[model samples]
Target chain A: MDDLNLLRDLGRALDREPPATLVRQRSRLAQARPRRRRPGPLVIAAAALATAALVLVPALLRQSGKAPATHRPGTVKAVNLLLVGADGVRGDARADSIVLVHLPADRRRVTVVSLPRDVEAPAACPGATTGGRLSGTIPNRSLTCVTRNVEALTHVRVDHVAILAYAGLVEMVDAVGGVEVMLPRAVDDPASGLKLSAGRHLVRGRPALAYARARHGLGDGSDLDRVKRQQALMAALAKAAREKITNPVTLARLVNAVTSGMVADRALTPAFLKELATSLERTDPATARYKIAPVVPDPRDPARLVLDEKRAEALFRTLR
Target chain B: MTAPPAVPETASDADLIRRSHDDPEAFAALFDRYAPMLYRYVARRLGPDPAEDLVGDTFLAAFGRRDRYDLDRADARPWLFGIVTKLVARHHRDEAARYRALRRTPAGAVHDDPADAVAAAVTAAAVRPRLAGALEALPRRDRDVLLLVAWADLNYAETAEALGIPVGTVRSRLNRARRKVRAALGDTDPTREEA
Candidate 1:
């Protein structure tokens, strides 16, 4: 390999080995033949400290991205796009997945909000096709059902929204690598082709998607329960992406894999995608906080849950 | 002179050095592996020119103290690093000045990439003026931890050992340093946002 390009890049700083100075010093020390002394408390403490240090130090470094290189900062204010995806048989492109992310310029902090797909919400400005007469009416559906509705009503200015169908989700999950989800309860959904035991399973691609999608065998058999599971999986995906998206080759692969079958608003052009990708380069998962919108289990309808607006507002206030 | 047989049982770097006190070559191999990392750490803190001298001084000091060295550990990297940290401590003025300089220059201005010349210059123009004062305001210990971790890539444990503190202490110091840096840098995300 041509060493220059590899050596000069920021990653090289991570991989560089020390030079000859140490070797020369070591030899000098070896020849001097220092006398060995009996074990003492100081020596013992030093040894203990070293042992304690060895195990703890490496793991902490692993928490952040490998190492930051000298790259120019992005030339704009922090931009956040709340990505949401949902399943809607009869709606004007409701985003089923919700990811509220704040991208800062320094690459220091990223805040993400993952919305439950089954959250019941009112539509802000219902489009003509949703079969609604009320221009600003609440829909009798999950939060995922009213994502675009909420965005429009609130004038939250969603930069982009993407919707992925079940099969597409499976393919995307498979492409980047599988996602890990912990089953709080046993789940067996014949229709979704999911049969998971109550343990930690590394489900990739299609099976993993099924696991994320399965609600029949989970908590209270509610879609909100499944949404919680989906959020957990996304946290894992973000971490994996932090490590995986380091190289340009892998980055291109990811962009191709995700963008090809993905659906987004027309404003999410190629230039916007580049800007977003560049913006996200430094969002390590270690520092980011993840939370779901607060919702109370409906007392009227036991199977459904309603958004706890008061607590949710408090949480959103902190985010703002 | 011929060296002793390589014994699997005599396993630490310190042990190897102890056993091979008669063989200078074996000891040299261990030194070679760690010197540059220490040098870079010191240089980043102290600057390139004097860093060379301090690095040389650190190794020489290590050589003088090797007789007192315990051979239990196979790697001398951490021990050598500790010595360099102490050496840097003796020249606190230079270290402080370096941080001050770093704060003045925009992070982009430090780029080694030729292609980024224009962008870096523009970035430096935008952010460099405000950063220096903010950096100057940070407590010395906090600045030390931030620079070492960000520039030197010392893991928290290694930083602790080098700084002669507990691991928890290192983490807290780092957190404080980062908070100050973020605040000074205007709470902007460096990767995607412009200054």
Candidate 2:
């Protein structure tokens, strides 16, 4: 053999990894890039004020088709709430966690489907999937955009959105008195401040916050792992919170935490939240299924993600 | 006269880097073109874990410094590879340990160098494992130059460009690298003593 044969052996060894990985990394880099900050305190304040007004209202007003369709009982038919967890709101914001908590007409099951952030814009051009080439608008209005994308992607209209910054998540976890989470592996990411060794961890408060917010220090360090972690934490939080919602003290604590740091659309009222909570309280937490929106590489743009139409439709139907 | 249909303009890497100054999105095309090959190259040297972070950082670094990129160089391959080479250099211990581990460890999982199973040809099997050993034995710089040529398939001039060394230095380094590898192997390579 020649000196070159060692290289050939090494190349074949390295090349064993699937090409999907490159596509995923490219899609992630494209979709999850931090946006540049634009000076807009006035706009943020105004939006915050509007959100405050929404929070104060007893019931949200909506006409049939004009409203984002939800299935909430009492005031609405179904409740579709987008729980957005981002580091901050104003500048260069991306929702590190987006979970669409869908309460069906029956309201027996709480389906929290976590959409993979790497869902490339369908209209993205070649090479647009990596940098500021296209879709810069997606990051700033992450909750708004992702909810809309989820609606389009799943044929499930998202009616309410709650943007919970890290502070709110900490409070919420504490309010429910934390949750028990079994690690798929030992997570030790110092980036997002998560450093738990793998085991059944009774995560709460700051550690719980770290667990949910951690985007690194896990398997493959893909956003997919974070998505899975977020889903698992959400389910655990829900299960824990379900037992305590009947207690006035705990409920009041949750309200305080949620109102302070949680930004929401005007439609999500305290009454609606109570009603939604009551509905989900009876259901088995095990029944709360989570899904990352099924995706396929765009035939036209290889790096970009598009809805896996058939499987996605099936998933939505099954969840619905 | 009727205008002929306009063909879409395909931007070269240097052209894209130049254009990216105005339109940052133009850089993704370069990433799509090279990141996989870059990942594989790094993965072979370091392993998968570091390769993921290093490869991502390499692109970000390339994008960060895109404006300062040498426009005279049309291809981004050498430039991208050079950035990753610097990153791999930072993990001197892990990189050294990797070569040592490959020497002592049995194959699979951590150090799965694909044995030349199909390419036995009733000939080159004996030669390749020795080459792996010789690779382990060489000094870091010579190993880098040899691997940059042999592994990355860069031309001698491109290897010189990637490593920021003179063309003559690349020649001497590669020759020195291969001589040591061949010497370590002794009579395994039929053309062994030519060096």
Candidate 3:
């Protein structure tokens, strides 16, 4: 026999049948939440509020013959909005990305702080005394848990909360006709099936999402690297929305897309969203600051991160 | 709302994967279809201990990534195998060690059906150690190409898809690997009857 056939024989000799059933694995699959879910009605209401802020605010101001105001004195001084990018079904969802959007009183500077999903934080769920992963608290108490834990961690009151499914993020990007991202080097992440050559490329909805989600074959292959990429993607999306959202048709499509994919708290009324959008209108994407919360490897567990207490305190103090 | 159509036993992998987007349970069918073959292939590379978990992980990863799956591709073997192959690549040390051990240990008696016992015995006793040594010595990428074809029974196109490489690259790697194996066998010609 040829060498190939001989090698085949060797392979055969090594083969053994697996157990009849992978009970543990099957249970893991059944329990595990699948990603890319359609948003429910609550999300649509939230999306409408967000969309109203983006699309309707300008038209409303135009019709009222009032110039868009940068800030309304005697109103809310600052807003700390917690935006959670969740994966899987509504109630069982887990936070894949946690971003704190800190819009100061001036509304000129938009500072976004990305908290690593694996960051150690006090569990907001009852019956849990010990601290757990920041991402884990979401499924237990919904966004309320995440908001409380983040408030405790950052010492900034979360004024509003918006939960976005990955599907919604994709639709929002596509609605804006995609965003441009600069890749430092070529990426071929087989896990996410994201392939792109080094350079600046305008990626559509799916590729844009892939660029953000890819971690294994990009940068240092750490969650920190992914955080940086997500920040860039967010900045790019902001820039795209600012530049490309011009015509009413595009605006309507964007509204439809965003509303279908996101849910916001009842406190985030349409009027509040409108004011938030107006304040952020002049906020230059270039001036927008993006930061990852200061973190150090947990002394007890290298895999998890504990906030750099001193630096984190200093950072959160600035936002407050 | 109307209920989803019943999943036929003969449903193509692509159909099941597309359905899995709406019904996560549909993914279990994919796991059942591919896990055994994946287990066997992974076991051949890294032994049986880690095989089960790796196969499970492959399915889980695929489940999470069902959105990105190309529905146009009818068969998911390449995609599924590709996922398992990437997982296996992480255990390169274990795979290399397994081959080194195989090279050192002598092949024992041929426990097989009576019909092919003579050919199996000749091939097993004489050629296994050399083949294992060649496999260990070959470059990682080349070995991946060679083994996917010889062991996993994937065609060139499927192997190319699995490794995320061009079909031409697959051909070249397979040729290079075969040449090394030939060199390792030297003039022994295990296929020839012994004097």
Q: Best-fitting candidate, measured by TM-score?
A: 3
Candidate 1 has an lDDT of 0.52
Instruction: Please give the ranking of all candidate structures by lDDT, highest first, separated by commas.
Output: 3, 2, 1
Residue lDDT tens for model 2, A1-320: 46566556545644536344344344334433444433333223223221221221112211112333444456535656666676553444445666666666665565777777667643332322224111233344435555655566677777777666656667778987888878778876644546678889897877886676567666667666767777777777766765666666886776566555555565655555545544443345557667787777779787676778898888777544
lDDT of 3 by residue, A1-320 (tens): 67887888777777676764443455456546544444464665576444432334444455457777745554657887788887544446667789988878776677889999889877556543225788753553257778888998889889888887767778888978999988888987645546789999999987888788777668898888999999998878766775666666767777777777777887877676666767655455557789999999999999899899999998898788
Q: lDDT of all the models against the reference?
A: 0.52, 0.63, 0.77
Q: Which residue runs of candidate 2 sit more than 4 Å off their true CA positions?
A: A1-15, A31-34, A42-320, B1-9, B105-116, B120-124, B188-195
The candidate with the higher TM-score, 2 or 3, is 3
* Model 1 interface CAPRI class: incorrect
Q: Highest lDDT, which number?
A: 3
Worst 10 residues of 1 chain A by lDDT: A48-57
Give all TM-scores, in the order shown: 0.40, 0.52, 0.57
What is the TM-score (0 to 1) of chain A in model 1?
0.60
Please compute DockQ, using alpha carbons, for every candidate against the native two-chain complex.
Answer: 0.04, 0.12, 0.24
From the highest TM-score down, the ranking of the candidates is 3, 2, 1
Candidate numbers sorted by DockQ from highest down: 3, 2, 1
lDDT of 3 by residue, B23-125 (tens): 7778887777777888899988998888878887888888888999989999999998899888999999999999888888767532334444454565776
Superposed on all Cα atoms, the candidates' RMSDs to the truth, in angstroms, are 29.1, 12.8, 12.9
Model 3 DockQ class? acceptable
